[model samples]
Target: MLAWLLQRQRPVPIIQMLCGPSGEKILGQLRVNSHLREHLRTIYAAPCGVDVTWIQEYLDGLRIPLLTEAQSEELEGEVSLDDLMEALGRMVSRKAPGPDGLPVEFYRAYPTVILPQLVQCTERCNTVAKSICEEGQLTCHAAHGASAIYRHALRRLLHTRKRARLDPDGSADNVLNLK
Candidate 1:
C-alpha cells in the first residue's frame, strides 16, 4: 500500500498517509482536503461515550469537596485587568501562533494597546450573551403564556359547542351567545 501510494503520480506535496479508513488503504490526492479531514474525523473522533445512568448511585455516594461561598464567588467573578495582564505575561513567547496566526510576541510588544482592546471585546461579548439569554427567556415565557391562552380558549369553545349540542332545542344559540 505504501509503495502504491508513493509510486502514484505527483500532484500535491508528498504526504505519506500510511493509516486510513478500512475500505481505502490509500486515499487519492484528487480527494479534497475537507472531505479527507471529515473521513479522518469520523474514524478517529472520540465517541459521545456510554450512558452512566447505571453508576448514578455510585457517583452520588462519592464525597466531593465543596468550594466555600467566597471561593465560588471569586472563581465565577468577571476576569479582571490584573488577571488578563498576568495571563498575558505568563504566555510563552515564540511558540506556534494561535488560530488567528498572531504570535504571543506581538501582544508582549504592545501590552497596553492590546490589553484594553481584548478586555473591551470580552466585555462586549459578555453583554451580548446576557442580552440574548434574557431575550430568549422572555420569548419562552411569552410563548408559554400564549399557548396557555390558546388552550383555554379552545377548551371553552369546545365546551360551549358541546353544551349547545345537548340543548333541548338542539340549537347553536348558546355557542352564538358567547361574546
Candidate 2:
C-alpha cells in the first residue's frame, strides 16, 4: 500500500515567486528554499497545548444554516442499484485505478458482479455511519439543538469557507478572516 501511494505521489515544485518576511521578493535558490521552509514551519509547527477558547469564540460568531426535515431525509435515503449503475455510467473511463488497481472499465464490463458488491459496501458504510450517529460520535442535520456534537464538522466547514475566500479567483469581500 505504501509503495502504491509513494508511486502516485509527486513532489511540489519550488515557488519561483514569493515575498520574504521583510516584504521583498525572495531571490536565489538557497534563500528561497530556506525562507519557504521557515515560513511553512512557522505556520504549521505550534507548541502543543489545549487552549480552545479561541475556537469556541470563532464558532460562536458563525451561524450554520439548518436543513429542513425533508432535506435531511433525502440526504439519508438508501442508495438503489439503479442509482449506482447510473453514477457508474457517468464516470469517465481510462482513469488511473486505486491501490486495488481495479478500473472503472472493469466494473462497467462486469456490472453483474461489481454492482452487488458496490451496493453491499455502501450499505455497510451507511450502517457504520448510523451507528456513529447513534453512539454520539457524530452529529447530523437531524441533531440541531445538540451541544458541541458537531463542532469538528463546523470547523471543517469554516476551513473550507476560508479556503474559498482566499482562493486566487475568489473575493474575500465580506467574509471574516478565519485562522
Score each candidate by Cα lDDT.
0.54, 0.58
lDDT per residue as tens, model 1, 76-141: 335446656766666678863345678888878888898787567555644555565567854644
lDDT of 2 at 143: 44
Please give each candidate's TM-score: 0.41, 0.45
What value does the lDDT take at residue 175 in candidate 1? 34
The residue-by-residue lDDT of candidate 2 on 43-98, one tens digit each, is 78977677999999999999765544553443334555776676566666986334
**Winner by lDDT:** 2
Quote the positional error of residue 100 for candidate 2 in Å: 3.5
